[model samples]
Target: MKYLVMVQGSQADYDALGGKASAHSPAWSEKELRAMSSFMEELNNDLAESGEMVDGNGLAAPAATRLVGLGEDGRPVITDGPYGETKELLAGYWVLDCESLERVTEIAERVLRAPAPEGSPVYPVVIRPIPDAGGGDV
Candidate 1:
């Protein structure tokens, strides 16, 4: 089965980088940033070796995002992100082809160990099955 594991962030986290395009900037101290980067690299490599990883990437900040949807009369509507009243922004995601939901959840728990600023609260990781093209959930 294929599952998507998502990491959430806050608007302030993006703002700390000054702009959405500066998403890769070191928002934490050098030590912390390096540790987090190393952890992610190791994790990705392990997943690859295990033949579980499909694709993964850190996304640009929410400020650089655009929301597109159908408006009344089926017209296209567009809006910028940093969406009002949103408590968390999607920071990154990993798509994994794993054996079970429990296994994916375990991987997400490991992701929770990713570094964060001291005193920061534990962020939620969303784990959901990716639906298949035949109109069935994978």
Candidate 2:
């Protein structure tokens, strides 16, 4: 089976950091940044060696995103994001081909353990099964 492991982040959290660029900006000491990078690289290596990792990548900041909707005149209207009441944005994702949702959940939990800012709260991870060609969850 295949699933998308979503790493989510709250908009309030982003705003608290001043904005998108500043959120991932070099405000952190170089040592902190290097440690985070090394931790992720090691994690990704483990996943790859286990043959569970299909693909994974981080997304650009929300401020760089846009919301598209129809205007009153029936034209496409594009607005910058940091969108509505929903607080979370997808910070990153990993596609894993695994035997069960249980395994995927375990992987998600492990991802949550990756290095992050000190004092940061644990964030949510969404696990959704990918559809197979027959239009069913894989």
Candidate 2, superposed: residue stretches over 4 Å from native: 10-27, 84-86
lDDT of 2 at 15: 46
How accurate locally is residue 124 in candidate 1, as Cα lDDT from 0 to 100? 83
Q: Report lDDT (CA) for all predictions.
A: 0.82, 0.76
- For candidate 2, what is the lDDT? 0.76
Q: Candidate 1: which stretches are off by over 4 Å? A: 17-27, 71-74, 134-138
lDDT of 2 by residue, 1-138 (tens): 899999876555454334223433323345656776788798789889999999999777677778899999999999897776655789889999998989999988888887655655467789999988778844
Q: Indicate which candidate wins on lDDT.
A: 1
TM-score of each: 0.82, 0.79
Q: Please list the Cα RMSD from the true structure of every candidate, rounded to 1 decimal place.
A: 4.2, 3.8
- Candidate 1, lDDT over the whole model: 0.82
| Per-residue lDDT of candidate 1, residues 1-73 (tens digit) | 8998999877676664343232333346667667878999999999999999999999997878899999998
